[model samples]
Target: MPVLDLTDLPAACPPGTAWLGLDLGEKTIGVAASDTSRMIASPLTLIRKTKFTDDAQALFRLMDERKVSALIVGLPLNMDGSEGPRAQSCRAFARNLDRIRPVNVAFQDERLSTSAVERFLIEDLDLNRKRRAGVIDRTAAAWILQGALDRLRP
Candidate 1:
């Protein structure tokens, strides 16, 4: 459907409907899902990038399986809050996906999200680089979605 702002998420995805969080990277797309009550977010899967069409299909399949109706994509904004090429690519990805799918989409500023996840994986969890790489993206996706869901709470 339409791309929404963070503030527009609750209204678009009412209660009892799940939403998917997407951390879109150049080579991989990390995915997470919220509980039906919209309270908890959990890392789901990582989709290795192939072609745009294939990527979109994979995303849709996930949404279909989970009955998710909304998407919260992490936008890689520069530290200065400027939209760089990465952010622009995210926007384009959202728009292009919206054109073909019927899910509501929104972006959450993802500054340092991956870094934060990486730090947690290392310091707190004691995971090495290889192990961190395995879960970093999906964990970052959860981080992004949790931030948005926190704002949605009263």
Candidate 2:
């Protein structure tokens, strides 16, 4: 499937399949997966950047293993609500993934997602710097996925 608008995602999914969320950073791609009921999102893994093919292969492997039915990729929009290079890069990545897999892909505005997750890890969870760094990306992926899931709730 092609990339979809946020408004179109809920209707696009097949029943009983989960959604996967991605936070595509320069150095790593954070991943999160939803439950079969599409209610909860949990941090799954972080894939270190290599080649695009490698990244896509790893993601597809996860999708196959997890029975994911859709994808939600973070769009790092500027504070002014404009697309930047990073957002374009994410779009490009989504496009590439779509070419390889027949899965619904959508973008979620990810303003301050990382900061929010980091603050939660530091202030709420009392994680140290190293621990925070190790898990921040996957946690951010969960944050992005949760935001989408909240919107999907009726």
Candidate 3:
């Protein structure tokens, strides 16, 4: 499998298969997954970053258990819509992930994803700062995945 555009992701997956969403941060990897119907995304878990091999193994274990068939990774683009070092890092991670599992991976623009999620946690959920910090990464991953799912709408 290869890194694909968001629009091309569906073709890479078999019907009824789920898609895993990843928000790769410096210290932790946020994980989310779409329903089998691909209708909704939910925050799953966060993987504390370690070695690449360990991280990959952790991610793969989750994917396998969830029956995920593809990936939608958050691409941290600059506000100017330009790819920066973070975007490059995401691409490299995607490439490495593909090499390990041969899974189709797509990048979704993730500008303001974390901020949006933080706002939701504060305003809507009314979570305390400490609580928010605990789950922000996974929530942001869900937001990123939701954006991709919205684009897939007919």
Q: In lDDT terms, how accurate is model 3? A: 0.92
lDDT of 1 by residue, 1-154 (tens): 7788889778877678899899999899999999999899999999999999999999999998988979999999999999999999999999999888777998999999999999999999999998999999999999999998998889
Model 1 misplacement above 4 A: none
TM-score-best of 2 and 3: 3
lDDT of each: 0.92, 0.92, 0.92
For candidate 1, list the clashing residue pairs, or say none.
none
Estimate the lDDT of model 2: 0.92
TM-score of every model versus the real structure: 0.97, 0.97, 0.98
Per-residue CA lDDT of candidate 3, range 17-80, in tens? 9988889999999999999999999999999999998999999999889889988899999989
Model 2 lDDT per residue over 12-116, tens place: 877899999999999999999999998999999999999999999999999999888889999999999999999999998988877876778999999999999
Backbone clashes, each candidate: 0, 0, 0
Could you report the Cα RMSD, in angstroms, for every candidate shown?
A: 0.8, 0.8, 0.7
